[model samples]
Target: MAETATHSGTAVRVYDLHKSYREGAHALEVLHGVNLDIARGDLTLLMGPSGSGKTTLLTIMGLLMKPTSGRVELLGRDVTSLDESALPALRRRHVGFIFQNFNLLGALNAAENVEVVLGLQGVRGRAARKQAMALLDQVGLADRWSHLPDEMSGGEKQRVGVARALASQAELILADEPTGNLDSRTAAQVVDILRHLAHTENRAVLVVTHDLGLQEHADCVVRMRDGTIVEPHDGVAA
Candidate 1:
C-alpha cells in the first residue's frame, strides 16, 4: 500500500512510549521505546502477529490504556497525564473505536445502540436518536436501523458498530481487527467505509489487524514484532 499524502498538520504524536507488565519477578515489556506520528486525515494500518504490541500501541493511541512512560499528544493536547474523569470526555469528543466483535447491545436496535454512545456523551434523547439514525444511514444501515443484533447478519452488525463510532463526530478512529468477522465482500465494504471516513471526512484512522488483504485500502502500514516497530512501509507497518 502507498503512504497517504502527508498533511501539514500532525494528528497524533508519541515520544518514546514504553509499556510493561510484571510477570512474576520479571517485567514483560509489551512496547519498547516506540515513537510514531500519524498525520491528520491519514489512514494507517498496523499489522503484526500475536504478542507483537500492535494492539498495545493502538490502545495507547486511543487513550484506552496509559503507557508506563512516554508522552502522547492528540490534536496538540498532551493526554499522557490526564485523569480518568477527563479521559472520558476527551475520548468521547476526539476519539472513536470499532472493535472486531462489533460490541453492540443485544437488546437494542441498530439506531438505539448508536444512540447509547451519544447519550453517554450527554447528547439528549431526541437529538441523539436523530444523529444515530443519520450515521446509520451514512453507513448504509438506514433500513436496518430498527433491527437488533441477533436479527442482523455479521456484516450488518459491523455496519451498526461503525455507525455508533461515528455518532460522536470524533476526529480519530481506532479499529481493532474491524473486518475479522466478515466474509471477503463484506470486509471490503467495511474497508471502503473506513477509507471514506479518513479521506472524505478527514478523520485520522488507525486500524490494527493481522489480515493482509486490508493493505490495499490503507494509506500507510506499520508492522511490529517482538514489542517494537520493525518496519514502516509507505506509512503502513508491515
Candidate 2:
C-alpha cells in the first residue's frame, strides 16, 4: 500500500471477520475469521465453486450485509461499527456496486438511471443529468444515453450499469458475477472496463466470480471454500 498524508489512505482492511446465518436449528458459519487488505489501484478477484461463500464475503465488504464479528476499515474509518444511517452515507461516498443482473430500471433511460445515484447524493436536475451523460460517454454509451434498458443490448445495459457505478466517484467498487450473463466478447469488454477503473482511476476493486476467463485481468486472486478464504495468490500464472 502507498503511504499518504491523508487520513483515509488505505483503501480497505479487514481483520478477524466472521459471519453466521441461521439454518434450521443450527447457526451456519459463512466466514471464519477472514483477514484481508486491499490497497488502492488494485483489482482483486475472489473465486470459488458454488457454496464457497464468495458472495457472502463480497456482500459484507460492500456493507450490504453486516458481519457477525470483525473489523472492517474502509479508507481508514472503522465501518464495521457504523450505525445504519451512517453506513448508507459512508457507502454512498466510498463504495460502488456492480451486479450480474444489470439491475437497471426498465422505466428509466440509461442516463436517468445513472442520475438516480447522483440525485441521492444531493445533485439534481440538469447538473445530475450532465454528470450522468459524462459517465455514459466514458463507458462507450454516449449515443445510447437516452435509451431504456429494454432498448439496449445486454452488453450495452451492462455498460450503463458500470457507468452508474463510476458516476458516484466512489473509491472502492464491489462487483458480483458482473459477466455472468454475457457472451465471451462482451464479458471481455466489461472486464477491460473494470480493470481500467482500478489501474487508471486508482480505485480498489473486488470482484466475486467463478469465471476463469477473468483470471488474466486480476492483480490478486483469492480462493474461498466453505465460507473461508483458503488462499490468496498473485495473478501470475503457473
Candidate 3:
C-alpha cells in the first residue's frame, strides 16, 4: 500500500491492500493488493460472490481487523499504523457499522436504541434523548419511537438500525448485507434511505452486499472475484 495521504473528499482509501490467514503452515491469501477509494457524498456498493473477501475488506476499513499488508486511510487519517487500542475510539468517531442482523437491544425502544450511541459519545441526559428522536425522525421512524425491535417489521427494525448508526454522527457508514433479510419492496425502501443519506447528508456509505438490485441506487459499484476487485469503481460521483 502507498504511504500517500488520503484526499480531502475521500472517506476511505486502501492501496495495495492484502490480507492472508494462516491455515496450518500455509498462508492463504484472501485479498490481493486491492486498491479503492470511497468518496464522500456517495453510496458505494461492494458486490461479490461468497469468499470473495468483501467482508474482510469491509472489516479492515471499519478498523475492526488489521490488514496483513497495506495502508488504510479513513477520513484523511492514516489508521493503518494506529495502535489497536486506539482504533475503537477512532472508529467510534468516524465509522458507523450496520450488520446483516439487526444488532439492537430488544428491551430498548427505537429512540433509546439510538440514544445509547449518543451517550457513548458523551451526549447524555435530555440532549441524547432529543437527538435520538431527531435521528429516528430522519429515518421516518418518529411515530415508532416507542416501538421495540420485536414490535417492528424487518424494514422498520432496519430503519432503527440506520437511525442508530446516524446517531454517532459517523462520517463513514459501512453496512454488510443490509438488505439481505428483507423482501424486495422493503429492501428498496431501506436502500432509498441509504441513498438519501449519501446524497443529501453528504456521508460516505459503503454497502457490502450481493443484491444487484441495489446497483440502481449506488453511486459506485465495485465487484470482487477470487479475493480481488475485478471491476473498478466506474460509477463514482465526481
The numbered model that scores best in lDDT is 3
The C-alpha lDDT values of all candidates are 0.83, 0.81, 0.86
Q: Which stretches of candidate 1 lie over 4 Å from their true place?
A: 2-8, 233-238
Q: Return the clash pairs for model 3, or none.
A: none
Better of 2 and 3 by TM-score: 3
Runs in model 3 lying further than 4 Å from the true structure = 1-8, 233-238
Pick by lDDT: 1 or 3, better one: 3
Measured with C-alpha atoms, the lDDT of residue 109 in candidate 3 is: 92
Model 1: per-residue Cα lDDT over 75-138, one tens digit each: 9889999896888778878899998999999999998999898888899788988898889988
Clash number for every model? 9, 0, 0
TM-score of each: 0.91, 0.90, 0.93
Q: Summarize candidate 3's per-residue lDDT along 41-151 as a digit string, tens digits.
A: 778889999999999999999999999999999987888998899998899999998877889999999989998989898999999989988999889998999998999
Which residue pairs come into collision in candidate 2?
none
Best-first order by lDDT: 3, 1, 2
Candidate 2 off by > 4 Å: 1-9, 233-238
How big is the positional error of residue 195 in model 1, measured in Å on the Cα after superposition? Answer: 0.9
The most accurate candidate by TM-score is: 3
Give each prediction's root-mean-square deviation over alpha carbons.
2.4, 4.1, 4.7
